[model samples]
Target: MHLAFLRDYHEALVIALARTRPTIERGTVAEITSLTPQAVSKVLTRLLDDGVIATAGVRRAALGKPAAVYRLVPESRWAIGAHVTRRALRLVLTDLAGTVHASATTALPADFTPDDLLGRLDSGVTAMIREHRLDDDGPRPLIGVGIGMVGPLDQATGTVRDAHRLRHWHDIPLAELAGQRLGRPVLVDKDVTAAVTAEAWRRDAGFRDAALIMVESGVGAGLWLNGAAHRGTHTNAGEFGHTVIQLDGPACACGRRGCLEAVHDRAADPAAAAAILGVGVVNLLQTLDLGHIVLAGADLLRHGEIYRQVVEDAVRTQVPRADWLTAEVTLTGLGTDVIAAGAAIQVLNLRYGLPDPVGLRLP
Candidate 1:
């Protein structure tokens, strides 16, 4: 079982490498992964047999025999992801390569309940499967559905434990319920965490230690630390909005006085709101020392330039040493599609991507 697990991890590692590059060769894969050539050869053979990768001719080096090349068969797997906001359910279809192929949105009733969400989720996944011709028995099959939702939730149990501002969501076993309703496997995670996963997926390894600051109906930060999603001990790491920036500020939806979100929302104009958000961002920088700060969410994107500039300025000017503590601030590349697309990618990652390198310490 241990050897089998190792083999699977190696395959996943190779697949992850293939996803980042256009093509991969045996020697290069072995070198990059620190695996023996024989092991890499065996893994390559298995991947070829499984149709996860395909040979792409051979590379001829001047000193040695030609090395076989392989590339990821991205269309070999598909996943559907849904972003459940307070007012809407946004769904997207993504391939194994994390590309969004199609998207659909349906507005929910004001302060929607779990059942209302499940109904829309059921219909949305079904419609996407039908429209995209995602057959379960076909060569390229739909893997599962992923949900990026509002938080104060437990990702480990896939349950929503009273999402902030949403009255109907307390101890809702969303993944299980959605899986039962849709007749497919489901994975649920906080929206900000999922959004950061999308950014990390697209940006590759260099995106280590970053924060995705979301300013949608409320505020939150999705943490990507050491190249993976950091959900904290209880899986409720991102409550950036509730952090008190002022001791005597306005009362927030979270029932806190002087919270970042409340102050930002209460600001007179977009510029003032952005400046408030910037201060919160600087505070985050002081704590996390993130290399990248991605501004996302509908509200922020509406005034993207202002938010981007204010945050950038704050990072450059506020963090002690301007020259040494440099950080890049920008808007999300995926735009509104980020969270949903990320959710879909999470499903793909669960199946085809690299497994977490934890708990197993090999000699």
Candidate 2:
């Protein structure tokens, strides 16, 4: 069993490397992943048999014999990612390479219930599958569905413990419920965390410590720390909006006073809203010492330049010795579809992405 697990791990590691590079040879894979040549050969054989990868050609160097080169077959797997916001349900179809091939969005009913969401999800997924010609007959079948939702949820149990402002979500078993309804496996995670995962997957390894600050119907921060998603002990880590920024200030929907979301919502103008969000970003930077700050969400993207400038100014002016502790602040490259795309990538990661090497060290 241990050997089998390690074999799977090595296979995932090779696939991950192949996704980044144009072609991979056995020696290169072994060197980068610290896997033995024999192990790489075994993993490569299995991947080739499974059609996950294909031999590109032969590489011959001046010093050694020709070596077979392999590359990932990105279309070898597919997943559906759903972003369930307060206002809409956005879905995307992503391949193994984390590329969003097709996407669709539909408005949700005001204060939608669990039943309402499931109903729409069932129909939406069917339409997406049919429209994209994503049938089970393909070389890469649709594996599962991943949901990026409003949080205060338990990722471990796949339950929504209590989504802050959503009335119909309390200890809701979303993963199980959606799985049963759609007849496919399901994975659930906080929206911000999923958004950050998408950013990390797309940005290469340099985006180790960062925050995806989303400002849509509400505010939240998705944390990517030490090259992985950082969900707190209860998986409720990205509740940035509820953080008390003003004592005895306006009452927030979460039953908190002077929350960052509340203050930003009550701001008189877009500039004021951006400034409020900027202060929150500074607080996150102080706590995490992040390398990147990605601003996203439907509401924020509407005024993208403003939010980007304000947050960049805050990081430059508010943080001490800004030159010494520079943090890159920019808008999300994926825009409003980030969370949904990330959710899809989360599904792919669960199945094929390599585990964090840091977590694999012996105690």
Candidate 3:
């Protein structure tokens, strides 16, 4: 086994425990990680030396020697997340503990290009750094940037693959461009996916299988399946709006007939729109059997209660055996800031999150 891999895995495990619990002792970490006390001691020493965790004095007991306690240093690192929508760009600064410290939003010109977004981001990030007085030379330094945008984009390659209704975004290497402009690492993901990540981060363990249904300028679903963001093989899975609802009903922006978005967009009123969206939600429930459905996005949130009730009622009545297979429907707790905050959380997760067990190589 590579010593580096062991170190990272152990460090991530301890950091995760420290974030949730009030304090962590070497023995408790050993018990949880199944690592020997000696191994846990080595990991703790490294984490303390790196300033990722801090000694929280000692916990004395009636038993053996007093064990040293440790806690996550939330401000030990920072990240900036940006939510790019058709109308505006929202940014948030988050600490290692995934707390949003500050946020700001800027308007975007209609049909903006890749360059347009990069300019706004460059200025906005510079302003945020200055405003917050985040020290680059400090023990806790700014990490990198994460961008969540409307998609049909490739998260792996950070390429925008023709975002519906946005003409200038065709096959743009946004992550590379933005990274060059901002002079920092960048991560790009679907807006809804990022929003769902934020929801998962804030909620407890029960939020494993869920979907964040967003209806801003368009409709999309962010899937959290089996405790992770379920980006499809192509990283374009959350194109919920384009799912055909009515065969030969109406033409859609993706050049399809009878899309859910087209019908909802053409609805006579918010009630009718909510009804259309409710049908889509039921379809998703039947397919995924999700435990939670979160409604978000500016357009949907304008009539948040109406949409929430419609989805909740649909899940209650439309799904067979609804009484037994209950699905919780609610609005996003973070409101409009969900995507940006989630993007920031992604950056934090890159550094401190646990390694995927499925991907880990066993000797």
Among all candidates shown, the one with the greatest lDDT: 1
Better of 1 and 2 by TM-score: 1
In candidate 2 the C-alpha lDDT for residue 353 amounts to 73
Once model 3 is optimally superposed onto the true structure by TM-score, how far is the C-alpha of residue 15 displaced, in angstroms?
Answer: 2.1
Clashing residue pairs, candidate 3?
Answer: none
TM-score of each: 0.95, 0.93, 0.90
Question: CA lDDT of each candidate?
Answer: 0.88, 0.88, 0.87
Superposed by TM-score, candidate 1 places the C-alpha of residue 105 at a distance from the truth, in angstroms, of 0.4
Candidate 1 per-residue C-alpha lDDT over 39-136 given as tens digits, one digit per residue, 9 for 90 to 100: 99999999998888999998888987988889988888888999999999999998888888899999999999999999999988888888889998
Which run of 10 residues does model 1 get worst, by summed lDDT? 354-363
The window of 10 residues in a row where model 2 has the poorest summed lDDT is: 354-363
Clash count for candidate 2 is 0
Instruction: Show pairs that collide, candidate 1.
Output: none
Q: Tens digit of lDDT per residue, candidate 3, span 1-363?
A: 698877898888788788777799988889988999999998899988888889889999999999888988888889899999988899999888778889999999999988889999999999998887776667658877899998888888889998878999899988889988987779888899888988887675678899999999989999988887888778778899999999989999889999999999999998889999999999999999999999999899999999999889888999999998899999998888889998988777777776642221110
What tens digits encode model 2's per-residue C-alpha lDDT throughout 1-363? Answer: 998778778887888788878899999888988889998999999999988899999988898799999999988888899999887899999888888899999899988899999999999999998887776657558877889999888887789888766889998999989989998778899899889988887776688899999998899999888888888877788899999999989999888799999999999988899999999999998898999999999999999999999989999999998898899999998988899999999888877876753231110
- Candidate 3 clash figure, as a count: 0
Q: Global lDDT for candidate 3?
A: 0.87
Distance from true location, Cα of 20 in model 2, Å: 2.2
Candidate 2 overall lDDT versus native:
0.88
Clashes of each: 0, 0, 0
Candidates 1 and 2 compared by lDDT, better number:
1
